[model samples]
Target: MALKFKMNRKGWLAVFAGLLLFAACESDPVLTGDEVSYAGDIRPLIDQNCTFSGCHGAGSVQFELLTYNQVKLKAAAIRREVWELQNMPKDRTMSLEKREKFKDWVDAGAPNN
Candidate 1:
């Protein structure tokens, strides 16, 4: 004998949505021609834009980006929020050049160098 399983419409939709999200997250990052450096380019931008008091700084509720390790851990979120969504830096706006640099760094695997 064979067993059979059934799912409702909502269940099917939920499964499809989850698969789509998984695929999106798994896809490789798109790289730009120019190289983006973590220390020289990205870190400065984070310090100037992201790590202010009450934001991503020390003792804050939000994710702290004080060090390379911390920033590297949240690299994906940073790309999504700052590069794609353009919703980060809550109080201020980052220049287009800076945003592109951030994307490039994340796409390059958020290297420590």
Candidate 2:
């Protein structure tokens, strides 16, 4: 016996759109060497922008970014919020350079160096 499945126009379009998005996302150039740094680049940026009182700091309701491990653990979420969604830093606007750094870091597998 054989089974057959059919998708409607909308379903096909949705699948195509998802594939396109995935391709676009995967097309980002990978960084190496000094392109992105965790201690020198990312930590300072996070400390200044994210880990403030009542935010992602210690004793806060939200996820704490007080250490490298915490930051590394939440790198994906940080990238999404900061780069894709552009909703991070709350009321403050993150600079393009800063946003790019975040994107590059996460895209580089969020190394802890």
Candidate 3:
């Protein structure tokens, strides 16, 4: 009797696992933009605006915003500068779209994309 009960429970567990997998297979897709690549999007924003005067350029700056790794190192402070302080570009040239995109990129685990 005990053996039979265990077998029945195992069968139900297997069925539940199959149903979970099938449900996952039917989910909607995740849409991302072509320019959403971190290196392509956010990096360019920093390079064009912040890094011009060797600030975060070919050589590392007080704030390293070149590569994802460099950017991550100073990400919090940079985010503060651009998002919180709004003291970036020193020229008020960074656009709203670029700022929102960068914020999304940073919020999304800062993926290399």
Best by TM-score: 3
In terms of TM-score, how similar is model 3 to the real structure?
0.71
Q: On residues 4-70, what C-alpha lDDT tens digit does candidate 3 reach at each position? A: 4445888999999999999998884466553456777887887788766557776654655556798
lDDT by residue (1-113, candidate 1, tens digit) is 99899999999999999999999988956655467889889999999998889899897796789999999999999999888999987864788788889898898789887
| TM-score of every candidate relative to the true structure | 0.68, 0.69, 0.71
Clashes of 2: 0
The models' CA-based lDDT, in order, is: 0.88, 0.90, 0.73
Better of 2 and 3 by TM-score: 3
lDDT of 1 at 21: 96
For residue 48, what is the lDDT in candidate 1?
94
- Stretches off by above 4 angstroms in model 2 are 1-34
lDDT of the structure predicted as candidate 3: 0.73
What are the RMSD figures for all models against the true structure? 11.1, 11.2, 4.8
Better of 1 and 2 by TM-score: 2
Best by lDDT: 2
lDDT of 1 at 60: 71
Task: Name the regions of candidate 3 deviating beyond 4 angstroms.
Answer: 1-7, 19-29, 32-35, 58-61
